[model samples]
Target chain A: MTTPTSGNPRAGGGPDATGKHGRAGERGGAGRGREGDHPGQPGGAPRSLATRQAELVEALTRAKPVPEGFDAVKVAAARVALLRKRAGEVARQWPMLAAGFGDRWKASFSSWAATQPTQGSLRDGWDFARDLDGRGELPAIAGAELAEREARWSYDGSAAPRTRRGPAVRSAAGTFAVQVAGHVRIVRLSYAGTRSRKPST
Target chain B: MGAAVAVAETAYGVGIGWRPEISGFVAGLPGLRFAEVVAESVHAHGDLPDGLPALLDRGVAVVPHGVRLSLGGAEPVDPARVTHLATVAARLRAPLVSEHIAFVRAAGVEAGHLLPIPRSFEAVDAVVANVARTTAELPVPLALEPIAALFDWPDDELSEADFLTEILDRTGALLLLDVANVYANARNRGEDPLDLLNKLPLDRVAYVHVAGGAEHQGLYHDTHTDAVPQEVLDLVTELCARHRPPALILERDGDYPPAPELTAELDAIAAAAGYPAITT
Candidate 1:
C-alpha cells in the first residue's frame, strides 16, 4: 500500500531508506541525534518521527497494540473515540444503511470498522454495505440504495469512485437500479420473500 | 502572499460554524458578521453550497477552517490540499484560514479523526515544517488550532503551553484558540484550565471556538453534538477578560437543536464575552 512520491519533500532519500513505507521519507531528519531512543526497539537507535507517527496511526486504526511507554487505558479511549467519530460520519453518508441497523448502527459500524482504516466516509459506507451484501445480510430497505449507487458510479473498493459515462444497471436483494445520463431510477421486483417497503425517495 | 491581515483589525463579535444542516438558521442571524465553513466541503470550481453564497454576498467574513490538512503531520503538507485551501480562501475572500495542529493520517492510512502529536521537539519540527509549506501556498494568514485529546504522548518533552508557544512563535501563525478544547484537555488530565490559559499567548488569538461536549464513561469528550456546558461559557468569560479575541465562533457539529435554542446559545456566548448579541 506504499504510494511512491513525486516531487515530495522526502523524495531525496536518507536514513528513511531503511523504513518500509513511503511515509518513511516524510521525516525531514528532525531530532536526528536526540537522547531518548525509541521506546521498545532492541537497539538504542531512535526511530524517526515519521515511523513513530505511523506506528501510532496503525495502533489506533488497525487494532495494533498500543506502543510501549504509552498509557494503554488512555490509548484505548482514543481508539474508541476515533471509531465513534467514524461511525457518525459514515452514518451521515449512508443513511439507509445506518438506519437499517437502528440502535445498533454505532456498535455495528465500530465492530466492522475497528480494524479497517477509513477510506473516507463515502468509501467506508460503500465497502461496509458491500460486505453486508456479500454475507446476504444486507437490509431489504438498503438494497435499492446500494444498487442505485452501484449503477451511478463504479468503485473497485480501492480508489476513488468515478461516475459511469454510459448507462448502468445493478441489482441487489431483488431491487434493480438503472442509471443513464446521470439519472438513476430504482425499480424493485416484487417477490414472496421481498419486503414491500418502498425505496427511500 | 497577500497582505498579512492584522488579527486585531476586525472585531467580528460573535459567530457560528455554517453547517449545511443549519444553513437557514445561520443565514437568519441578522447581526452575524462572521462564520466558519469546513474547507473540504467547499468545492473550488463548482457552485458554492446553498446559503454560503448568500453569506458571502452579504459580506460576511467566512473563514475556511480546514479539518484534513493535517498540518502537524510528520509528512510535508500535501500541495494539492494546500492549493484547495488557498483557492477556497480566495473564493470566500476570507480574512484568514485556520487548521488544527494535529495529524489526521499517517503511513498512507487515514486516522479518520485528529490524533494527538507528541509535544517533543521533533514533533514541533515536523509541525513547523508542515506549516511553512502550507503558508507558502496560502494567500491568507493561517491560524493553527490546538485540538483536544483524551490522552497525551507519554514522552512529551515540553509542557502543553511551551509546545504550543514554540509552534506559534516558530511558524508566525495566529492561534485559533478553542475554549472547550482547553476545558476538555484540562479536565481529562486533572490540570487547571486557567493555568494553561494564563501561560498561552492569548494576544495571538485570531478568533475563538466555543463548542459543547459530554462525559462518556469517565472521560469528558469534546463532542460538538452536545449542549455547551456552563463551565465552557465561564472559560469564555475568563478568556475575554484577559484578551478578547476578534471573534468567537460557536461550533455545533450534529444533533442540532431548534433555532431558539441555538439563538440562546449564541446570546449566552455574547453575554459571556461581553459582545453584543448577534442572535437579534
Candidate 2:
C-alpha cells in the first residue's frame, strides 16, 4: 500500500526506537495530559483525545476554527453534510414540521441546528418546533402537530418527554388538541389558511 | 448459564436491515434467515416493535447492530451504552452484536455520525480498551466494523489493514466487513480495493455489509440511502471468491425504493455472493 508522503508524523505518533507505537507526546500534544480521563472530570487539565475531539466536533458543527494541520474545506463540507443528514432525520420525526418549510426546510433547519449538537431526531425536531413556536413563526400545520404532541406528552426541553397520564389540552396558533385516557383528539382547527391541517395524533 | 442454551449462532443466506419505515417489506421476506436492527432504536425492557416480535416468533435470527457506543473514544466506553446494547442483544437472543471501530462523540459532544479513527497505535489502544469494557457486559460475541472516512487525519501511523488487524488480534473480536466502505475508501484514494481485501484477515469476518452510495463533489459517499451500485456488487463477488462470509446484509437507511426495487437489490447481493435469492 502506498503511503501519503505529505502526512505529518508529529500529528500522530511516529514509529520510535522501542518499536512501541503511539507515544502520546509525539502527537504534538494532541494526547498530552489526561489522556485516558473522561471529559470534564472535575479538574481543568485538558484530556488529550477528549479535548482535540471536541475541537474537531466544534469545527464540524459550529464552523469554529479548523485545528492545526487539518484541511479547512473538508471540515466545512462535513459540517454541511452532517446538518443535511440531521435535517433528513428530523424530517422523518416531524414530517409536518418539515413540510411546513417546503424547499427551504434544509436551509432553515441547518441555520438553527448548525451550532447545536444533535439531541437525537425526536428531540431535535421538538426543540426546533418549540423554538419556532416561541418566535411566533411556526406554520399552522406544524403548530397543530406540536400542539397534539404537547397534549400527549410533557417535555421540558432538557429531559425525555413523559406521557401525560391525565387529561391535557394544548393550543398553538389557533390549533387546539386534547388528550384524555391515553387518546388525543384535535378539538379545534387552526384558521391559518389552507396549510392548517389538524394532526392525527 | 447451565449447558449454554443452543442458540442460532450462524448467520446464513441473505438478510436485510430492519427499519421501522419498511418493516412490512422486511417482514415479507420469506427466505430471510437473519436480520439486523439498530440497537439504539430498540427499547430493551419494553415490547419489541410491531413486526419485530412476529419475526422473532418465526425463529428468525435478529442481530442487534449498535451505531453508537463510541468504542474508539479516548475515554473508557460508557457503561450505560454497553448495557443498553447488551440488553437489546439479550432481548432479541441475538447470536452476536456488532459496533463500529469509530467514535461517535468526544469531549461531551455528539458528532451525530461515525467519525474515522486515526490509524495510530494510541487509537488501537483506545479501541481495544473500550471493546474489552463492552465485551465484558455483552452475553454474545462482538464484531467491529471499520467505517467509511471522508477525510484522513495527519496523525495516521499504520496502514488501515495493520490498524484493524492489530485491534481484532488484541481484542479477539470478529470483523463486520463492509464492502461498500472498502469500495468508497479505495475509489476515493485511487487504490485497488482488492489490495485492502487481500490484506485483511478474511477468516475473522463474521458477516459483510452491502450498501449503496453516490458521488458528491468528487467523493463517493456511502450514504446507504441510494441503490446498491454495480461496483459494490462486483467487489462483493471478489470478496466471496477469497472467503465467503456466512452472511451478507443490505442496509438502506432512507430514500427507500418500492418493494420490487428492494427485492432486486437483495437478489443482486445474493447472486453476487452465490447465495440463493431470498427475495424469490
Candidate 3:
C-alpha cells in the first residue's frame, strides 16, 4: 500500500473533489438526494413509462430466454446480488463512468424499480435476472474482447490516497467508474478479465 | 432480558464509534476506550483485523454493533447473521452487542437500508423472536437501539417509545440509547424523545450512542457526517446528568475535520455532564 503523497493521474484536467462535475458536497441543482426523495416530477399529465425509463431499462424483453432451469428464488437472489456486485464491479474498475451518471442514474434505478410488476412472480423473475448477472451467472465474454473493453476502463489516476501504512491495495476484482470533477476514473480490479467466470466443474 | 447478559455492567469510557475511514487509526490508537464496530462494517469488508482484538487486549473494549439484525424485519432474524455477530463479539470480548430499535430487513429481503417498522404487534413479535434467537447463545447481553426515523405510519398502533419499552420488557435486552436519535425523532416527528425516555425503564440502558445528522426538507437525515448537533448535546447533557450509563461513544462518519473538532465535541460532553475532561 504505497500511497503516493502527490500528483494523482486523474488530476489531469480532472474533477477536484470540490470541482463542479465530481464535487460531492454541491448537490443543490444536481438533486443527489434519495431516488424516492428526488424533486417532484414535471408538472403535467403523467407521461407513459417509456419516456421516463427508455434509456436505463435496456428493454430486456428481448434478452434471449435465459436458461430455464434456475429456481425463482435462485434467479431473484442472483439478480439482486449481481446488481450490487455490478455496482461493486463498477466501483472497482471504472469509477469514472459512475461519476458520469448524473441524477439520471438514481432516476434510472427508480424507474426500473417502479416498473416492478404488480405480481410477486414477475417481480421475482426480474430480480432473478439481476441477481444472476450479479452472481456472474451469465455466460462468459471472450477473453480478448473483454480485455479490450476492460483496458479502455483503465484509470490512470493520481497516486492513491496515503494511509498510515501507505496506500492499501485497491481491489481489482471488478470495474467501477466514478466521475470526479470533469474526469472519470475507471478503477479496475485485476482478474485477467476473467470476471463473471464460472468455476470449472 | 433475552438471556442474562453474562458480563457484568461496566462503562468502557468515551470513544467515537467505528467507521471504515478511521479503522486504521482506531486499530493503532490505544488511548480510546471502546469501539462500537458495526457488525456489517466487518462482514461487508472481511476478516476483522487481528489488531482489533489486540486493541481490546490493550484495554479498548471493541463491541460489535449492527444495523441489519432486522430484529423487526418482516422475517425472522437470519440465523447466519446472528452466528456471525456472536463470533465477532466473542472474539472482541465485548461485554454487550447492540442493534437499532428499527428493522432494516423485511420479509427475508434486506433493503441495505434500515426501514422503520410499523410498530405493531406483528412487528413486535417478529423483533422479539429474532432478538431472542440472536442472543440465545451469546455471552453478552444483546442491546437494542433507538434510531432517528423519517417515515411514519398514521395508523401505527404503538408509539416508538411505547414499542421500545415493551420490546425491552419482553426481551429483557439492554438498551443502547442514542441521544441523537432520540432528539432527531422528537424534532422530526414532533414527539418528545425525553418524554419517551422517561417512560423507558432506565435500568436497561447498558450504553449510549450519539452522532450528528443533517437537516433536509424539514427532516434530519442521520447522515452522521458532522459534529453532534446542539440539540443532541443538550439532551445527552441532561441524560448523563440524571443517569450516567455504562459507556458513552461519540459518532462521526464523514466531515471529520481534525482531532480538535472531535476533542471540542467531547469537551462539550464533559462540560454538560460536569465530568472532568478525559486528558488521555
Candidate topping DockQ = 1
Q: Candidate 2, residues A1-201: lDDT per residue as tens digits?
A: 101111111111211111221223322354433333223334434336655666677677666677654666666766788899999988877888999999999999999998877766777888899899888988877876788788977777765566778898898756787777766676545344333223232
Q: Higher-DockQ candidate among 2 and 3?
A: 2
Model 2 spans > 4 angstroms off: A1-47, A165-168, A179-201, B1-11
Error of 1 at A107 (Å): 0.6
**Model 3 TM-score relative to the real fold:** 0.61
Give the higher-TM-score candidate: 1 or 2.
1
Candidate that would win on lDDT? 1
Q: What digit string (tens of lDDT, one per residue) describes model 1 on residues A1-201?
A: 111121122222212222233555533355433444564344456776677788788889889877666788888998998898889988877888888899999999999999988776777888999999999988888887788888877777766565678899898766888777777777888653333222222
Each model's DockQ score: 0.34, 0.21, 0.04
Which run of 10 residues does model 3 chain B get worst, by summed lDDT?
B104-113
User: What is the C-alpha lDDT profile of model 2 across B1-280, one tens digit per residue?
Assistant: 1111122235487898898879999889989888999987787676677799999988888989998788988878878778889999999988889999998876556788888877887788899999999999999888899998887765677999999999989998889999999999899878999999999999888889999998888888889999999999999999999998888999999999999999999999999999999875
Question: Candidate 1's residue-wise lDDT over B1-280, tens digit each?
Answer: 2244465558999999999899999999999999999998787777777899999999899999998888888888878788889999999999999999999888777787898899999999999999999998888899999999988886788999999999999999999999999999999999999999999998788899999999988999999999999999999999999999999999999999999999999999999999999977
Q: Per-residue alpha-carbon lDDT of model 3 for A6-66, expressed as tens digits?
A: 1122222311211121212221223222233211333333222111111111111112222
> Where in model 1 is the C-alpha error above 4 Å?
A1-43, A191-201, B1-5
> RMSD, each candidate, Å?
6.3, 10.3, 15.5
How does residue B175 of candidate 2 score in lDDT? Answer: 90
Clashing pairs in 2: A12-B155
DockQ for the candidate 1 complex? 0.34
